[model samples]
Target: MTSLNEIPARTESVELEPLREDKKKIFEDILRYFETNQRGYIKVPTGWGKTFLSKHIMKKYYDEGKLMLFLVSKNNPLLSQAYYNRKKNQPLFPNSALLYSERRVDRKELAATLRALGQKKGEGFVLFASLQTILGKQSAEIKDLILKFTDLAIVDEIHNFINNRGNDFLNEFGERTKILGMTATPFQGVVGNVKFVDEIAGDMREIYTKTLPECILDNELAPLKYTIAESSEDIFEIFDFEKGLGELDRQDLFLDCSTPDRLKKVIRRTQLAKDVYDSMVKQRHAKTLVFCAPVRKRVYGVGGGDKEINAFHAKLTSSIFNGDISAKKLEKDIEPVLPVDFKNYTPEGKFRDAVFISSELPKDEQNAILAAFREMGKPPYVLCTVGMLIEGFDFPGLETLILLRPTLSMRLFEQQVGRVTRLSPISGKQQGSIFEISDSIDSLYQRFGEGVFSGEKVDQVQMLQPEIRLEELFSEGDAARAIEEGKIEIKKVELGLRGKGKGVKIKEVPVKLPPTSIRAKYFSRLLALTEEKDVGAFEREKRELMRAALKFRVRELRDAEELAKLAANVNKLKREAYEDRRLGDVSRQHKPKVFGEVEWLLKLQALNSLKYEGEHLSLQEKNRILKTLGFEPDFRKIDSHRLKCLKLGSAHKTIPELVKVLGFVSRLSSSETYQFLDKKKKEQWKRELLPAVYWGFCFIEDSPELKDLFESTEWDRRVKNIIRQK
Candidate 1:
């Protein structure tokens, strides 16, 4: 087993050339495009220095005595870098002034700079501001002042501007002031009904284009390599809504649908922690970036008096460290900038090679942390973050990217993977390595298509799946049966049975248990049995194994019975309350009606009808139904109908038509045709029916009444016929 404590010593690094020669040729081509077009944006891969190229254009306009306005989005690192560069008196853009909310320059001085630029006296001065600041209602005066003085505006990462605010900012400028927008992926996603690429194409022309594969071929970026680490444990075994319904009801699982997403997140974090630690052990000298799952804080507003805890972040960080240390000392060492409500819990670790950063820290403090991480000989070589380091941050020597966060957004995945593609030949870094720690890669490829790599082959690394231990398998309720059935593999064992004075029998047996300390304990017990001499003692020893096997079966049966009884109680409650009303109305001279635990479905149907009719049920009707469903009536800001369905374990089937189909299943479970099938076949039929109905209901909704058609003997055939016709 690979352990966290077995990290190897750091290897020495080698030095190489500062910059690749091909950048000069690429730069010359881009310069020619800009000179001919006068005003247009160029598409360059990340780490190809779009900032450097944009600055080149800015300097040209500066030399010609034209003032420029440079805009970036919020949370962008370029804003901080520009601020730092100006403070350090760097040559990049020394004559720049900031107009963001955190500006340190006096308004009088800003006004003076704008006045000088407007009068053509401040020849080289430029203005930098975030889009939020320029579009703010409070900054209307300054916004007007800058627009009047600026001759041209440069927008970085313009794909981020596919929003109402971005459109509003662009609308303020005209052809008198040239608008140049730069981005790597303008066609990232759709804004409302239009693609972002199409929406921006009308306003900006593509001056030059460079794809990721082209960049690699031209030696502009390092070649890419990636790996997908698969977790041995399956998440489905931990959760089964139907089989665990009774246990789930006791815990009120359906009341909050977020439970499933939360469980997946925690499990994903744990798996990533192991693989990330293993990767660090393999590459002790590499500069690595780890993207962790978002920090999830659970706020206890009632009993704890409004307290918050960073549950997953703390767990993941401690798992990565995996060291022996006092919880208090560990907590104090890796303290977060913001206060947490960890009344009884603190993470334990003493690992100092990694540093965690988030937006909770002040901007200046975040900058200082990044500066320390950039030091080659520093103690902290790995930087862990949730989302603070994905965009616009340039670290050419970063050689590895460990992705612990799974994303469905193509734009987000691209930005994250781009972090390590920068060339760092000076630090002996040749190829970039990406470690994808989850199963989200397939969906991402399907969504974005294979052209994401631009024909660049991404080599796969085969990671060994973690081992399975006997204790772990035995402790798991579902997998315990595999051990008793001799399905698991254990090392061979030999035992000697003594029959007479000098005669002895030896037998070799293949034990069916996973390799673990528990296997050794079992083998020791078996050896004790083989040494028994007396008949009674030998029988007693043999019965011990049988007793242990029976214990597991008994526990499994008991759990099933408990779950069955709990489900019965829930159904009885729903049926009883509804039947009482039905019987009461019958005694009062009304016709009796057939009923079951179907009021929730009826309520859903009534709501759907009312919504379709452009109306709502009376308050009395709503409260009456809600009260019978065991929820308080007229609760503030709560969706009563949806909550009722969730509590009843039918949250996903919310549409009236689907609810009606489930109610039909409840009715059919008691019908003659359904009762005629054998137990095993009946279970298989039900499992097939539900998912089939869920996926095919739209095609067969108008074919016939579900109850009437499904109640027949040939109901399965009718279902297929109806679906095939559509």
Candidate 2:
């Protein structure tokens, strides 16, 4: 065990400019806020260099001789990102350490080193630990040691730290400690409720739309498209608060899906999705990603079971270890599973083996699988877990994503999509494709609707678009021409002679012409001619065409420039403006109003209307009363007064008085009437009043009435209710 006393006092700093102007401003604001207050929250989207910023901040404090603790989620990818950032950009932290599940170190030695670095007896040094390790008590001693020296703490994936299990750590740190919580998804429920020492930094939509989305759409980065599948049954029922939530909390129910039978169901569904992917690949020859749930196998008698059974299992394991398995099985079982239709799959000599990657595999095995998959000829596909692929894994040849799992959280869904969206460095192409097979449309909608709702944003849900028959795109003659052209490139490579040795000139025998370039041109022409009459349609076609062309191009272009240009063109089409333009002007004009309407609807109050006449109100009379109260009245615009009245219901207010007011409810429930009057007398809490306040900067400049209402106590109660609802 490493002791704190042995650790050296080595810390260094690096100068870094923010990746973008907005980022720079946001970074400065965050730093300034922290400088004044000692703690703050910064919300920036993934790929926006949050890790870089964290490192920069760490370096700043390290240079000042303050002990800073950088905390991250237990996720391996995130840990890897931190490690890479430190190693490459901030290399001066000789005392820095990584705490994760796989890494083991001597605690005594570490502690001694920390002590030597002035960490003991109220001294401190920087330490890195995953939230899980911290929470699990694995790093209890280290955590305590750091606590002595800790002046500041940086929390990554802050949202995860707010959950019930994580709250303990937060509470432990408490008000005394200055803490910074960082997350891309800042609004887990209500934005205001999220804890921050002083200030919240950056706008989520602005950063995503202006920075990340632009990079993706411009093919400066990898582009992503989503495909939503409508569900036949309401999947929400399975996640209902009363029943499903409790079940999810229980280990048995949560892990039940990992059972062999349940896994079979998943496998069957995955195979069906894989079949669709296969047809697409055959038609276009594209690389693809196959995401699956975690694999947990119970080797019944492997390690410490019955002696006879253990011996047999041990023998089998040893056989696997010694390479007794044939190359075919080694390729099949050891290598990552590639997306191929085994039912009628015939490899074209190039793809001899498929790759299978899983988190369950040992690190050596995982590396070997990746190497084998990469070594396979063009149009290689790999089967990987959602867990492993969501973070650090980058394969440029990945042009297609086969979504085998459905997720609702936009952050997770987007991250998974991002795996394929990264421009394949190998091919230098900008865009990728996705093939999603789901039983439910709502699931698809939830996963893909965010960007679509933003009129200025391109709909990324094109990955799920159904495949169209390619026969109509070209005649047999055209197909033949493409095939011939593709073969020509192969012939050129094969016919070129080379000297194998001195005085031995090898006559290069003509190699069989491969259908690569011809296929790419055919796919490109097919894409160009593909009719897209709507934004949704255009996005779908654009992604598919890009996938096909890039898959072919990856084989031809060894140069980066050509690949980048191809990628850029594909990315441009994925943009909302570009897709909308392709769909014609009507879409562009309607987008803003549609978003505005949705926003308005979210703020509307639920009410029943009634009409009254004299002492007794007939059904018809009650209907008239309801109609007069603006319950169902047709309103052309959503203005301040109307919005207020919608939020604050009326209760048996005089119709004439209501009509006199610019916006008033003629009738409301008795309860509402009392509540409204009560609300009028209270002091407002500005942060709690407007429902749109949760939208942060969007409603910051709300009308005076809204601003005043928000400052009242009544607004606080309403905000609490909204938080509870979330």
Candidate 3:
């Protein structure tokens, strides 16, 4: 709870430059509009000093004895960007304080600061708040504090709040306060289920806008050299169902990084970016900035692609650039051994681990890396980021931007492209280079609009045709080679399971089956049998053989020759299962006729064993098992010994008397029970024991056991109907 009172005042001084004539006019026009309007938004390009203009205007209101609130979303570097700007431009608001989640205000200190500022005329206090922090779980008190003290609110990156959560916070400040929202892209086109432009218009009026073209024309920003390379469909189709993915909702698939199939696409796209960077621009360095596709986890996982055939995975490539030599061991063996104190010791011209930054990183660590990246001839000469560096962040030395992910949001695309557009005289940067890796350049041109990056030169946007197509680099044999070389970790993916072809590449399987489909499940099991170690398959086969032998015994089949024949047939089926050969041929030829209505009881036992281990049984399996076991499978409470004794003509005695005479055989240990009964009776009971105790016992109407069985059956039926949508 570091409050304003605990924080030190800014003592350093900064020389200020007079705003350019065009920028000065735009700034004054925004002030003039705010004088008449209560609420409005300003749209301007990224490098146009939007933060300075807004803060300058807020200071005017602050001088008029008004309390101002500067707001941005949580995890937004803008909050910190504004904080640093405040330190540089101390004359803007002398009594300003930060109110983000990381550095919260003490309630008492905040009240005192506001109270003192409130007492004096022409004195104001600005609370720079993070919307994500103020509107979270413990937001009631903080929201009340903001509403009580704030007179005017200036929201930055306003496009982020075009949702119910944002509206609810906005609605809290009714007519008592005036609002002004600012963003480079005022309307974000269409996002998810709604039209974002209409939503923004309903909330605030768009008073001003400055496009990239206008900014470039005014010489306010650097000219950009754009290049596009379409990723090969053949490389993508190397993974199953990727070709058919065109028919599916691509936007939804893109967001879902949970599945290995989708993640493989992202990895291949990233690998293409790496190749393009290596061939086109790695030597020049020139402070490259890379934007990668979103991943669920930033660290270790199975990433599919081949370099023995052609591509470097996302994690491995990042580790190489980041100078994190240790991470490479997950994919392959480490090459040269490094000094123990490597991270802190940057020997001579050796690069360091500042090459990668993402939203998943801690704020302080991200800030330190960003600071390093901003400097010219730095360790992170080539920097990679997920999405954190796209908006608000300023880096004049960014001369190269590589986009590895495609976006449907025009605003986001513009923001990503704008990162490298800032002019840097010290670095002698006249133009920025943008290398885009995607499947279609025509679709990009159509989606982002034509001539979006038009410059004074005729060849502003260049299309670089790859000499060796991505598809040409891949072969069906490369996947197995990469796995053998330990470059690709083989994941136990539950896809493409049913095919019987041994050593079949996953890319060749083109059928698209839902993850939960019965066919997909069978395929996964089949894949495990063929691709994985034989231990699991052997255990499963042994269990099946033992269960079959028990079934023959239960059926009163005493022929040793028939038993031997059944064991041999089971062994053949097991061998075929491991060999990826069809089981039907062998089964039909030597299969036993032991499968009957009573055999369903043995199936129940097998299915129940799976349940006992907490494995998920499919709908068909669940129904079959439930139908055989009488639903509720608990048997510990059933008086099996008492029932057996009563059936053997001991019904005249009470339950207690029977327990005293028969000694509760189920509760007694095996050796103790055998001592109580003769050898013949003991063997007979042992053979028929468990099933007789569990289901062979009789139950009358209104009994608790009977009620539980009925309830469990009804519940199973209800669940099955719901799951099947019956």
**Maximum-lDDT candidate:** 3
Residues 1-726 of candidate 3 have per-residue lDDT tens digits of 675665444333223446768767977887787676667788777887888777666766766767788898754467766755544544345567777667666856765666655555365667788887777665556577677667788888888776557656876775657778888765443221123322533446777877665565566777655555555533233222232323122211122233444444444445555545555564454788777654333212333332120112233346545535432232342223222222322566444633566545577876777777777776667677655667776887888887665554445666887788788887888677787664532222233232212210001111111111111111112322332333322121111223564321222111111111222222223223322323321322222222222221111112222333333433454454444434354443322221221223233323333344223345454344333333333333223432442343222233344333222333332343445777877544433332222222222121454334322322222121111110
Report clashes for each candidate as comma-separated counts: 0, 60, 4
Q: Go through the candidates in order and give the C-alpha RMSD of each one to the true structure.
A: 23.6, 19.1, 23.7
- Candidate 1, residues 551-651, lDDT tens digits: the string is 11112222223323322443454345344543344332211111111223323322322223212346555444335434465524124554453344332
Could you tell me the TM-score of candidate 3? Answer: 0.51
Better of 1 and 2 by TM-score: 2
Candidate 3 Cα errors over 4 Å, as ranges? 6-16, 85-92, 115-121, 136-142, 188-194, 197-203, 234-272, 295-314, 319-350, 359-364, 440-726
User: For every model shown, what is its TM-score relative to the native structure?
Assistant: 0.49, 0.50, 0.51
Residue pairs in clash, model 1 = none
Models sorted by lDDT, best on top: 3, 1, 2
Worst 10 residues of 1 by lDDT: 456-465
Candidate 2 ranges with C-alpha deviation above 4 Å: 1-22, 84-92, 115-125, 135-138, 174-177, 187-221, 228-272, 279-287, 293-354, 370-380, 386-388, 391-398, 408-411, 423-427, 440-726
lDDT of 2 by residue, 1-726 (tens): 333443444533444554566556755666676655644566543554566767766766766666667787656656655654443554235557666666665665765655555534333346776767765555677666665556678887666664455555655553335677776544332211233221132111122222344444333455443332222333332122234222222211111122233323333344444334433344343555566433233322222332222112112212222223322333334222222112111245442223445445578866665655554254234444435556445565666666544443344554555566455557654456665554432343343333222221111222121211111111112232333333111111111113453321212222221233333333333333332234432333332332232222111212212333333333343344443644556545433322232222222211110110012334454334324333443322323433453333221122233233311211221234425754443222221122133322122233444344333333233343332222
Off by over 4 Å in 1: 1-39, 83-88, 187-194, 233-269, 276-281, 295-311, 322-351, 362-365, 440-726
CA-lDDT, candidates in order: 0.46, 0.40, 0.47
Highest-scoring model, TM-score: 3
